[model samples]
Target: MKNMRDKNSTNSGFTCANCGRTVSPAAKTARNHCPFCLWSLHVDSVVPGDRAADCRGKMEPVALFQKRDEWTVIHRCEKCGKELPNKCAPDDSFEALLNLTALQQ
Candidate 1:
């Protein structure tokens, strides 16, 4: 769970398992994402930051949120209860994504 945060702020990443988009890290931190299916590797090393985790988990999209300005994707571990936020990808399935949002609403 080391190096889990950018600026030590609860650690975060741009391309997490939920958003398979290719992303640019702010600097040198690890960018999390599969760049295809948006499935995350079980990286339970930091709760949400750092590549220190050995879990290398497969993060599955479970929920969605319609914030004032952003639509955050909530992902739950296939093996754990941990959750994280993910930015939507352009290639994300519109139908599936809409269904997820519909259920949330």
Candidate 2:
């Protein structure tokens, strides 16, 4: 079996699947979504940074929610219909987050 706690799990940059923008890795945490469009991929099965999923679907930013001071973006998979929440990155577009927040209200 493969090592589950491998240190080789890198926080690498990737091209946005939804917006086609080049995304850089986050400074404090593993970036699972695009900071430009706030879109993500269904790559993790149960936890963050665990690339154990095989869905490979485009995750659409559906809603925004807050817990105290921090905000999170809820992404829904287009192919598998799974919903996941990712914390907002510092470099994420404030305008886009506002738009999602407005839509939720």
Q: Work out the TM-score per prediction.
A: 0.52, 0.88
User: All candidates: CA RMSD in angstroms?
Assistant: 6.4, 4.1
Cα deviation of 87 in candidate 1 (Å)? 1.6
**What's the residue-level lDDT of 89 in candidate 1?**
52
- Candidate 2 residue pairs that clash: none
Off by over 4 Å in 1: 1-38, 44-49
Tens digits of lDDT, candidate 1, 1-105? 333343444224445445545444434333354434546655645544445555556777678776787666776677766777765654455776777767777
- Among the numbered candidates, top lDDT falls to 2
Candidate 2 per-residue C-alpha lDDT over 1-105 given as tens digits, one digit per residue, 9 for 90 to 100: 133233366477788889999887688888889988899988887886777788979999999989999988989999999998888888999989988988888
Predicted structure with the largest TM-score when compared to the true one = 2
Residue 24 alpha-carbon offset, candidate 2, angstroms: 0.9
The parts of candidate 2 lying over 4 Å away from their true place are: 1-7
Deviation from truth (RMSD, Å), model 1: 6.4
TM-score of 1: 0.52
Against the true structure, candidate 2 reaches a TM-score of 0.88
